[model samples]
Target: MEFQATLGQIVTAVIGAGLQLRYLEEYPEPFWRPGDLSAAAWRGRLPNAFALVASRPG
Candidate 1:
């Protein structure tokens, strides 16, 4: 079975793996789309995806 993790859990896992947390950005829209959609259409909706940036310690 597959296990889903919360955002905090994922971030913590990354930190535990020796990566320094840099930044994270939550996206309002999904990367894959079923049809054409406008930015205005996503304004009040919840985020469907996010982008995270981390770097390994030098």
Candidate 2:
């Protein structure tokens, strides 16, 4: 598989597109536990995962 954009690049592109960044977080391994598959539980469990919340201006 080929690599694409990095997290920073993504954020930059989002902002450039006129979206407002509300929340941004990096989910490291320590933030999760085994057998945690729920949305709130699996956030930091997966590898190379991040939580980014953005929205367009009203």
Candidate 3:
């Protein structure tokens, strides 16, 4: 599959929607590496997955 927007774009959109960024983690490879079942083997790959937590103001 192809990505329409980038990480920065997604973050910007979230901020624009009035949500505050709390945590952000980027995985250097697909979170579920189909080929490499071991973490050590996939540790040095390029990032393709993102994990983030955002919240709205009280």
Q: Taking the tens digit of each residue's C-alpha lDDT, what string does model 2 give over 36-56?
A: 456643565444567899999
lDDT of each: 0.81, 0.77, 0.82
Which runs in model 1 stand beyond 4 Å of their true positions? 33-44
Ranking by lDDT: 3, 1, 2
Q: What's the TM-score of each model vs. the native?
A: 0.67, 0.60, 0.68
How many steric overlaps does candidate 1 have?
A: 0
Q: State which candidate has the highest TM-score.
A: 3
Cα misplacement distance, residue 22 of candidate 2 (Å): 0.5
Screening candidate 3 with a backbone cut-off below 3 angstroms (N, C-alpha, C), the clashing residue pairs are: none
Better of 2 and 3 by TM-score: 3
Provide the lowest-lDDT 10-residue window in model 2: 39-48
Over the stretch 4-43, how does candidate 3's per-residue lDDT look in tens digits? 8989999999999999999999876665667646665377
Candidate 1's TM-score reads: 0.67
Regions more than 4 Å wrong, model 3:
1-3, 32-44
- Steric clashes per prediction: 0, 0, 0
lDDT: which candidate is best?
3
